[model samples]
Target: MKDFVSVIITAYNRQKYLGYALNSVLNQTLDKDKFEIVVITNFEFNKPNYKNIIDIYDNQEYLGEKIYKGLHESKGDIICLLDDDDMYREDKLERVTSFFKTFYPIYYHNNFVTIDDKGNEIKIIEEYLKIPPYASFNLPEFTLAIENNRKTDIRNLLKLNVNFNSSSICVRREILENNAQYLRKIKAVIDSFIFYSSLLLEGNILLDPARLTYYRIHTLQTSSGNTKNIKEYKDSFSNLFKKAVEDFYIITEMLNGKINENILEIVNEELLRYKLLYKIFSGNNILIKTKFNIHLLNYYLLSLLPTFLGNLYIKDQYNRTKKVRSFQVKSSNIF
Candidate 1:
């Protein structure tokens, strides 16, 4: 029998957290027969002989392909994603199922709590996501309105450009299958791909404010695993930018390169921000040829002015910095 929800858990060799992540699903308040656990991993791990039938797909492939494989194999109409290092709250599946039924959103992202490697919750933390615009009182969730033109939809979503934790992501199966092309190219920026594709395909997105998943933070993540200095930091930022650029390119292909006008304008601004920061910190020449928006006035000055003047500005900022070792060099002048 087809399940109502397929909780697809993508894992690697992390034996430590996989059990906890799986147990979280097993412990869900939802009926065990209503939802099935689909484990996709490269290696064969211990699968608990539980009442809920858990299917395993063991293969070695890249991140995108692995996700595609799981999506292809899931038997449920509603797909819920759980990363290997993350765990879901016991009520998450129940809430997510109801959220989809009422809102009928193609993509759904619930809020999540950040936890350490030891499962301790972290408070007062800086987060990667912004509060979704449409989520408000009484509603307490977000649903993107696509009442405008395609260009407007693209522009507004790209402007917002908010991404949440992967484990908190859920979607209707057909939307993901129809847009699997975008998923194929994605490696590490899965959240961005899912988000942009949902908007690109004109599917409504729902963002729930409820914390339904536990997003694990550790020193093992690729971006923070081995970063040592400003140079490494620059490299890491560059890598992340590259991944996002790939997503943009995939979108361009989807639109047959027609939205090139301002589609990449936001991405280009982010690139300039990185280059501008790198030059200021490394004592190098700022890329004066690149353009910046009005909000980035200090960056605009750094690029528009002469090379020597830009260097002086960098030096000035460096001198005023409270701690150079901390990479907390303060912002540059505006006027």
Candidate 2:
């Protein structure tokens, strides 16, 4: 029997374009005998054109849980994930199958695609990444990229970051089994977290240069999902910032003493970013009213304003960001 490659999709009420995603997998250049696709849904799957497909039902309110369950249930030698609204290239599985056949462990690839919503193509979100002058060789390049805050890497990946777009990754089954317990801890989009965790465990992650995937940019995306309404702005930013803080601590712990200097620099930047984000949320009157008491109100403002202003200064070090530059010029030069 040939080694099986599993393609898993986690979706909720995305009936409009789920077929595009399913067809993308079915059309893969990889042999049908060698791979299978699993669609995990909260609703019953009624589509008849699915191939080698299995439906795993998850009633959880969060999409992450559905993914977790499907990932756990899959028994293929290699595994990949696709979101409901996204589609993959015809050669996606072929590229991944070849990579895993050789590497057989932790590996991810670069992703190139456009974001489209409401039948219109939006601006391209591309990056020109350059590794810092002084980065430690202790960790792999992909891990370094994630740590150093470089979202894209034209050369070797120093760390796992945006370069490992979830749709573009494939991994060995052993990794999932070995890290089964840790997978439960993930609640939000878990790809980034899993990539970082794999690096911490294996000390190396391979990246193929082939951009063999299409991550559809749709209106129902997680980022723009519930925050489109003006009324949800403050709460959205607040919850987002709080989640950032929690992720920071988790990553710091994951890195342990193995922390590389380049990674630490990025962590400091992220901390500052969250601090600034919290401050911005505090300044919003709508968020302030959600809580009671003058003490709590003052507490929110006191913690937020200074850090928010500070993060703006840190972000100004890069290219021409007007918001950060203006904030830097107005604030005291205490850096």
Best by TM-score: 1
- Give Cα-based local distance difference scores for all models: 0.60, 0.52
Off by over 4 Å in 1: 1-3, 51-61, 124-162, 223-241, 255-335
**lDDT for 108 (candidate 1):** 78
State candidate 2's TM-score: 0.66
Work out the TM-score per prediction: 0.69, 0.66
Question: What lDDT score is found at residue 17 in candidate 2?
Answer: 70
Superposed by TM-score, candidate 1 places the C-alpha of residue 255 at a distance from the truth, in angstroms, of: 4.1
Flag clash pairs in model 1: none
Clash count, candidate 1: 0
Overall local distance difference test of candidate 2: 0.52
What's model 1's TM-score?
A: 0.69
Q: What are the root-mean-square deviations of the candidates from the true structure over C-alphas?
A: 8.4, 11.1
**Residue-level lDDT tens digits of model 1 in 1-335:** 33299888887665668889998999999988789888887777788898555656666434566778787776898888888888999999988777677767777777776565567665422222111212111223554434322355443444433344568788778757877876777656566556655655555676667777877655444323213443454344445544544555565565454334564564455445545544543445544465447746775555566667755654443333213222311233111
